[model samples]
Target: MAAMLTQFEDLAADNTSGATELIQRILALCESGAMGNTYNEIREGLNLLEDAHSSMPSLHTVIQILKSEFLPGLKNADDLEQSLRYIVSLQKILEESGAQIAEKFLSVLERPTRILTISRSSTVISALKKAHKANKLSHLYVLEARPAYEGWRTVRDCSAAGISSTLMVDAAMGEAVQTAEAVVIGADSVSSDGYLLNKTGTLPLAICASEFGLPLYVLCDSLKFSPQTRRDVTIDEHPDSEVIEKEESDAFKVWNRYFEWVPINYVEAFITERGVFPPEELEALSTEETAADE
Candidate 1:
């Protein structure tokens, strides 16, 4: 963990210089369950993000709000570190909050579960490895999660390992689920109820899979488990301004965020390193689940 933090510190020292790369790297580490080093660096780097732009009121207000109301009165590096880690762990908390509840549910399931992997995400990779070791990885299906063409990563990775896989476009999930026993996906964040917050098109996929009588499974680590209330929680829309902005579209709101969320109801199961459970049971298992990450 300390080693991970050092790497994060190096990358996060400047938000604009390579913030996205650093974030990508940090996510890679966190997904691997060896993020001890990155945890601290990410926490420390929050200060850098808060200072990313000196002129943006929205950014400034968020930082100020974090300092004043959310994590007020922090004095030392350690306290600040803990606070920042907590903030970063918001996604983690949402992703994998169950312990007791999972233990209860998981105890009833047999090994060698069949899962149809739809999206390619670090979270998906993490789940694949864990389930593979635990004798649960049955099959992997690659959804051509597109626009950015990220699903290809999953297909490539799985194929390299000789894992049986089939590639489909973003639209074929509903049809594919007919043969699929279960639909498994990775999450960018797991809402308190285990609603899978992930890439923009994930929710529709989950919905389609659900309607097809397939169980929607979310494979996540507990760090993404958010304890916060889900009352209109804001999703950060990213700058698509760089994409079509140069294409002469409307100058305003041209950009979009990198992700979207599927509410918790469609989720049938959530598998985490700690355990697995129904989405509604997340908050009840904070015991075996420790809050540490970014």
Candidate 2:
């Protein structure tokens, strides 16, 4: 557990990394014998990561959501081999879903054009790479996701990949949106109603996209879906040090929230493993299902 938690910390601390890679490392720990014999034991490991690490909701929520789909099938598996088999099965599902989600983006990126995205979503990065390989991506406009300045990492990555991209300040999202034909983002969680919880500043960018009559798309696997609504998730605020690196004068306070909820109305569609779906199309899959419902 200590070693696994350390891995999560190192991955989370890097502003450039995303939840997909984080989750993959966590699962690799499990595959290498970190997972215990019973389903509860495995879940306890995940719970510890959820409680202790500053990881994103999507990291834990993806497994939690998949638990509902796969755990019941494991009920009849009484031996360790059987238990591990189910674990391996779940891992395969996640990996394949990621590939399919990337493919969806490749299909959508039909021409060489500029796109605007903020923060760093592993899902978004993978898709962009695929689109670039197909020669469909001309440029990317990345916002300097403030405090952390994750956009610098995005620019670095795009440049390394031989894709043309520009980094702009957070406030320049409105300007970026004017030239971008569409806006794409990654989600930390998607409510049953299709609202998105992502890095701070995403909501305003979506609003800008809406006002400019541009479509905003979210790229994520189906595992990112959460039964919880926006009200159920606790949105955490980061330390003021991330915002102001000065004397501890109590003259003013800084509300540095790392994430915010973007209403479903602002989103045009979601690109999931299944395919691109309008917000309403996700309703059936996002609904909280009972054992019987499953």
Candidate 3:
């Protein structure tokens, strides 16, 4: 249990990984905990994870599944084995969902297309790789997500995959959008009101894409869809030192927020593992999912 808690703590402190990667790590931690710990200890570890990453609805969904469906049945070693199997199955499903979403997104693009994207999204990187393999990708424009500079990881991944990519500053989003054929990004969460919560620069990128009449695609799995509205979500503020080296003076204030909400009206479509959905259709989809859970 102590080892499991340490793993969860490490995951919580990780700001470099994308949402999909984080969810995958959460499942892995849960699987390890379920195998070695008692039901109560696993539950305690999960509670710690939940408190640490409360903003991630997808992570919460995985926790909810374990709590309501699997944990209750953990009465013996056999039950623990069954729970481990289920967790492994969930991990497999998540892995497949990324590929499925990539396929759907690639189908909508023209061959030899240039894509502009912000931040480091594992899902977007996978889709980009698939597109490159299929001869659909020409070039990629990656915005160097500020403060954390997560986009550097994306550029590195693209280079390793032999995909042509250019790294630009976040402020150059307008130029990037105008130069690219389309804008593709990943979402942290999609609210019931059809708003997208993602990396801080996403809103500006969407606006630029809209101004240039380019399609803005959000590539994510259905697990990112949240029952909460934008009002209910809290945007995380990072350390001020990330923005400036000096301490805050009385004259100036440094605001280092890492996430922001993008109005869905600017988006062309949401390409998910299930299918492509327009912004307007999201409300009904959220409603259906919420009803199913109830």
Per-candidate total of colliding backbone pairs: 25, 0, 0
> What is the per-residue lDDT of model 3 for residues 167-243, given as tens digits with 9 covering 90 to 100?
99998888898799999999988887768888888988888888889999999999998878889876677786788
Could you tell me the TM-score of candidate 2?
0.83
Clashing pairs in 3: none
Best prediction by TM-score: 3
The TM-scores, one per candidate, come to 0.59, 0.83, 0.93
Write candidate 2's Cα lDDT for 5-58 as tens digits: 555455445444566766776666555543433455445555556663242666
Query: All models: lDDT?
Result: 0.55, 0.75, 0.85
Q: What are the runs in model 1 whose C-alpha is more than 4 Å off?
A: 1-24, 27-46, 49-114, 129-138, 231-233, 239-255, 286-294
Arrange candidates, best lDDT first.
3, 2, 1
**Candidate 1 local lDDT, 90-167, one digit each (tens):** 435433543232333344336665556654555555546555555565667777765555677777877676566778
Candidate 1 positional error at 110, Å: 5.6
What value does the lDDT take at residue 231 in candidate 1? Answer: 45
Candidate 3: which stretches are off by over 4 Å?
38-41, 73-75, 248-251, 287-294
In candidate 2, where is summed lDDT lowest over 10 consecutive residues? 33-42
Better of 1 and 2 by TM-score: 2
